[model samples]
Target: IFCSQYMSWTRNYGVQGTIFPAPNFNPVADAQMLAGALQGFGCDKDTLVAVLTQRSTAQRLTIAEAYQSVLGRDLIGDLREKLSDHFKDVMVGLMYPPPSYDAHELWHAMKGAGTEENCLIDILASRTNGEIFQMREAYYLQYGSNLQEDIYSETSGHFRDTLMNLVQGTREEGYTDPAMAAQDAMVLWEACQQKTGEHKTMLQMILCNKSYQQLWLVFQEFQNISGQDIVDAINECYDGYFQELLVAIVLCVRDKPAYFAYRLYSAIHDFGFHNKTVIRILIARSEIDLMTIRKRYKERYGKSLFHDIKNFASGHYEKALLAICAGDAEDY
Candidate 1:
């Protein structure tokens, strides 16, 4: 996909001209836009699909209303008629009112007969902090069932628990007081140094529970008290997935870009790359923070992340991932 940059440039300048920026979403205006696109001259189905599917859920609703007012048609019903399964799925995902419903659907998919592991991985592992919270709410609202209960029934062991904890989305809002920040930092330092279960608990609290904004303040406090970067301490004491997880937390805490750079580096370096991990992270973060990941990759690795993936990975899966990483994968 990174190698395709040349092609992207060619498309930008040659035949395609420039891709139009997405319109500022207004439900009423959006209905007009959709009607115009549908009924007006030279409006492409692909363009309509892109615009309708890529907008946030709220924007989609507004556009839906607009679509009816302007075109006298149900946007979703029209979409179903014109688009096939894959595209329809993307559009429908966007059209759904609450994200929690989506989460609930994913949860049920995982628990239903013939479990969809990919859906589980995609939902549980990839959501933003805010999205995860919405999902928890959605699961409860849609099913009147605890998301955690479904997860426990469907998954086993520590990995299951980790996913549940993440979905639960509990975290401190912020640690503004310098004294409190220092105390949390001291606790983090002790945990990293000891590598005990207590350490994991504290690390999870700081990483998974706290907001990134708050964690950053906590990292500074850690540095102030310990005279060492939090990352260095974790690296020294922890090993394997435990270490990788903690490092991810710390990297996310200090610099998300740098953290992703590390992940990108891990994806391609050594004998065989962890393709699943690479694909999972890329897919999960692409919509949420991929632009930031691209920036971080350049700043930390001194080259495009896409370039490295192109150099290292092979085949169609590689191609799909590259397209995704390059920000050209069809929006869903």
Candidate 2:
């Protein structure tokens, strides 16, 4: 949805990205500074956080290349040696291109004893068709496993079916038809009302097949006829990961940045950090729309994400998140 219309969408909405190509960015110079930060006894955590967090992913990759050329050492390897825990995770996550990072997260999410269903949902449900394709390609290249096959083995039932549909990355893009929206809305309302196991695939088909633009129209048409939000209906009709996956898709379609804002809020609101979720959202969206997510975070939660991070997180981890956050919405 976002990929196909990205050019037009950014033009219409204006990009609210937090990070960009650093001005006067000399990769060799930046690499030298990073080497200096990493070389000494204890490593300079402050310099590492400041330099890495502020640059775009593209810029960071260039710096990494320069680091290898200048010092004959791998930047990511050096970071792994020096940094530890969640702080190290965040720094390492920042170095990869977006597709590789997403692939890495997805691989780990499904790698161990149990699948991190939320990680799968967070990534697959929210990505555009092109993004999904890249991730699938990366997953194969890096892990030598098919993403869809891995997902199929890891999950089951209606939830598995839904993920399978999404993994195909075949959603219709851009164009919308209001007439179809009205028809699909009725179809969805009836399916929800039935709540029969029979209608599960039907629900998945409509939600997964339509363009995001068309789906938004369907949702509005749904509200007009049913007098309840589509999410509420899905909640009423479904249970478990199936319901959660559907809800994530709907929210992402409605407002991608706002959906991510809710994710950041949920991650930190539980008194301690859900470090993986927190790190994923901030790093993934840093170049795309973290600024707008910050704006929505304030609008939805009534406090700045930065403020919440400071309250729930401490030390270098907090600093890296804040640096990605750029600053509080209130400051702007």
- Tens-place lDDT per residue, model 2, 88-139, is 9999999989999999999999997799998999999899999999999999
| lDDT assessment of candidate 1 | 0.61
Instruction: Judge candidate 1 at residue 288 and give its lDDT.
Output: 50
TM-score quality measure for candidate 1: 0.56
- Point out the worst 10-residue segment of candidate 2 by lDDT: 1-10
Model 1 lDDT per residue over 200-308, tens place? 7666665667666777778899888889988788788766544555566566556555565566676567536655446545544544566567777777778777677
**What are the models' TM-scores?**
0.56, 0.94
Q: Please, what is the whole-model Cα lDDT of each candidate in the order they appear?
A: 0.61, 0.89
Where is model 1 poorest over a 10-residue stretch in terms of lDDT?
14-23
Residue 254 local lDDT, model 2: 93
lDDT of 1 at 115: 59
